[model samples]
Target: MPKVTFVQMDGAEHAVKVAAGTTVLEAAKANDLPMVGTCGGSMVCATCHVKICAADRARLPPPTEDEEDTLDLAFGVTADSRLGCQIELTDALEGIRIQLTSTM
Candidate 1:
């Protein structure tokens, strides 16, 4: 299991042990975090937008073309912005920290 940290828009952080193969959005939903995976990990909705911490950015695979296109419609697209639904948990993602964007 990977111990991942999700930082809420309010600057609060929650850490959880996530099983391998789980998407970041799944972990957030399971932990009651604020990510709204409206499109259910289909890369259609940008509701699960998040900013990957600089330190963990390189640990993830680059977003797909569809994900990148969807992110362009997101609220706060940054250099590290990514859709949580597209980030799969793996051994390499242990201790990964991502901040929830203000989608409201």
Candidate 2:
């Protein structure tokens, strides 16, 4: 299992241990973290947008073209922006940290 931390807007940290095959969005949902995956991990809606911590960003796979296109429409987008559904957990990503892009 890999541990992930979701940083809330108010600076609260919610950490969970998830299976290697689980996506960030799925882990968040399973743990009752505050991330909205409006498109159900289809990469269609950018509602699951999150910002990978600088230390963890390099550990993730590069975003797909579809994810990149969709993320362009997300609020509070940044260089580290990524759709949570697009990030699969891995042992290499242990202690990964991400910030929810929006509460909604």
Candidate 3:
């Protein structure tokens, strides 16, 4: 399993350990985070958007064009922003931190 941290808007943090290869969106949903995850990793929506920690950015691959397009509909997107559905958990990514983006 790989452990990841999710930061809330108010700076609260939650740690989740998930099996390797599980997507961030899946982990979040499993943990009952307040995410919409409306598209269920279909790559058609940005409801699962999150901001990767600057130091952990290298552990993730660049987002696909489809992800970028969906993110255009997200709120408060930044250069570090990525769709959680596209990020797979792995041992190499242990301790990766990501903050949930505001849905406002």
Candidate 4:
């Protein structure tokens, strides 16, 4: 299992352990974290945007063009910005940490 940590706008954090194929958004939703998935993981909405912690950012897979396009509409976009719904959990991301922006 991989553990994904989500730090909300208020600094509160939630950690959820999930299977390798789970998406970050799915992990967040399963744990009742504050992430919003307006498109239900369709990659059409930026509501599930999150900033990947620098330490674990490199472990993630490169984002697809569609994900990159959606991230452009996200608030507080950073070099590590990613659409949670498009990020699948993997063994290398066992302790992945991400920061949730105020917009989502």
Per-residue alpha-carbon lDDT of model 3 for 4-100, expressed as tens digits? 9989888989998999999989998899886778888897878999999778998788888888999999988899999999999999999999798
Model 2 lDDT-worst window of ten: 95-104
In the predicted model 1, the residue pairs found to clash are none
Q: Estimate, for each residue in 1-104, the C-alpha lDDT of model 1 and write its tens digit.
A: 99998998788989899899999999999998888889898888799999997779888888888889999889879999999999999988999998998876
Compared with the true structure, what per-residue lDDT tens digits does model 2 show for residues 1-104? 98888898889998888999999899989998888898899888898999997778987778888899999889888888999999999999999898987835
Provide TM-scores for the models: 0.96, 0.94, 0.94, 0.90
In candidate 1, stretches whose alpha carbon ends up further than 4 angstroms from where it belongs are none
Model 3 TM-score, 2 decimals: 0.94
Predictions ranked by lDDT, top down? Answer: 1, 3, 2, 4
Model 3 gets an lDDT of: 0.88
Task: Evaluate residue 6 in candidate 4 and report its C-alpha lDDT on the 0 to 100 scale.
Answer: 82
For model 3, the superposed segments whose C-alpha errors exceed 4 Å read none
| Full-model lDDT for every candidate | 0.90, 0.88, 0.88, 0.84
